[model samples]
Target: MNNNAYNINIFSGGAELLFDNKRHYNIDLPNKDTWKLGDLLIWLRDNLLSERPELFIQNNSVRPGILVLVNDSDWELMVSSDLWYLICSLCQILCKYAPCP
Candidate 1:
């Protein structure tokens, strides 16, 4: 992945987006990430939908939602999701190659 770019997909409510560097747009994320599906959903709900709606892309794109099964466990047990683990791991890796702000 391009660490220099904040090419993260922000999803909230009914929006999907790709923030490539500082340029945001609507795009399809047909790839997989390390985040636990449920945790990512929670993060999006809290961060994007409720907090910074400006980071979301408003267009006719598919909802940018994280969909993944963590260790074959359904994400309804609340704490069994691996989303935070994946996020923390990814953050550590990205931090090593962070782009200068």
Candidate 2:
């Protein structure tokens, strides 16, 4: 593995159906120091998301009704002053979308 590259696991809960029903992904992200949660979100949208990108992303962040957990911690609690949290190696990211009423 490249020095700048690190592995991460992504889990899609209720949102798996939108990603062709695939619930898990083992991703190797290239670039470590420069990567942030915001960047990861964009990367996921452009590279992994199969459909309904709008439902998952809005204003450069996840839309309402969707929960993003980083390393088992709520993303909101991890956000920094700029709202972009630095991503660490071997972290787990879980994206869960609440069912519509």
Candidate 3:
């Protein structure tokens, strides 16, 4: 395990269709002393997202109706003084989307 790199697992629920229909992914992020959830989002959008990026990203963040979970916890609950949450090594990120009627 590279100390500077973070190996993370990403899972997609209903949103997997945008990721080539793959539900799980293991990826290594470039070395950095600190990584924020926002950074990860950009990385996913640039690297993992396969199609229909508009449906996944909006205003530099995930579009409405998309749920992002880090280590099984809702990202919204993890926000603090800084809106962007910190991410650690071996973290698990899940993106789920629930369409509205």
Candidate 4:
């Protein structure tokens, strides 16, 4: 198995139903040096998501109510070209708030 790992935490905010009431996952990222946020998103859709993925993603981006943080900082701060590369360098968290269901 691939050992490139990422830590992720999920908060329901009513979205947990689609994820089988589960809230956290540790994923082994694909072994690629160019891995980026966009790549991670696609990986999540394929690997971690359960159903109704639209609640977490829309228009090839995260839904409005979702937040992405990296190493305790907002992912927005480091965004470039709709992607941020080499995300395996730190912890990542994707969370949703309020009635996002």
Candidate 5:
């Protein structure tokens, strides 16, 4: 399961997880051969867009919470957001695999 094809550029690094600068984390990951495009839309709908009545209509959309955009388009509006997610997921999944300093 070597995932050398992907890497994520974080907006920040360190404990604060800030969002105004650039940072990066690289790790070996498994290939995303098992994922599909539909998975990305579902994740956006479940994790970002779906709204509760308590929130405003505009706020209901995940449009605001998107921390980053890959290749200019948001994953929610792509032919295969899953591909992006797969790459990003690899970042999360392999985070613990980092070598200790």
Candidate 6:
């Protein structure tokens, strides 16, 4: 499978703390034509998560507190386990999850 590049902008509301306090990333996901948002979450955990992975993902999905957006649209609007927008699934994900204070 070939690698595909995607960009995800993180906010303090999400897992930014685990990503070096950064907020922008251009990541790559394998393109076997079978990747989905669910798969992406796992990939993030395995490849990008720096610490406390449980904070971002749990029970095979993103924790309840976090909110996910794609192309400025709610991820729930498009969270299928199939190829979503072959144009750029991972490229347009924006996550928000305010850490408990």
After TM-score superposition, the amount by which residue 61's alpha carbon in candidate 4 deviates from its true location, in angstroms, is 0.7
Name the top TM-score candidate.
3
- Residue 45 Cα positional deviation in candidate 6, in Å, after optimal superposition: 0.6
Please tell me which model should have the higher lDDT, number 2 or number 4: 2
List pairs with backbone clashes in candidate 3: none
Q: Candidate 3: lDDT over CA atoms?
A: 0.80
Clashes of each: 1, 0, 0, 0, 1, 4
Which regions in candidate 1 have their CA more than 4 angstroms from the true location?
1-6, 10-34, 51-101
Candidate 4 stretches greater than 4 Å from native = 1-3, 80-82
Score every model by TM-score. 0.24, 0.84, 0.87, 0.75, 0.33, 0.78
Clash-forming residue pairs, model 4: none
lDDT of each: 0.31, 0.77, 0.80, 0.69, 0.34, 0.72
In the range 1-99, model 2's lDDT, one tens digit per residue, is 554343444556677766767877777666556788889888888888889899889987888988888888888887755588877766678888886
Clashes of 4: 0
Which prediction has the highest lDDT against the true structure?
3
lDDT of 6 by residue, 1-101 (tens): 23577777664565688777788888766656766677777788898888898888888778888887877887766656343433455457777886878
The pairs that clash in candidate 2 are none
lDDT (Cα, tens digit) per residue for candidate 3, span 1-101: 66535444455567888888888787777877788899888898899899988988899888999998888888888876567888777777888887656
Better of 2 and 3 by TM-score: 3
Off by over 4 Å in 2: 3-10, 80-82
RMSD of each: 13.6, 2.1, 1.9, 2.8, 11.4, 3.4
Residues forming the 10-long window of minimal summed lDDT in candidate 6: 81-90
Looking at model 6, residue 49 earns an lDDT score of 80
For TM-score, candidate 2 versus 6, the one ahead is 2
Worst 10 residues of 4 by lDDT: 92-101
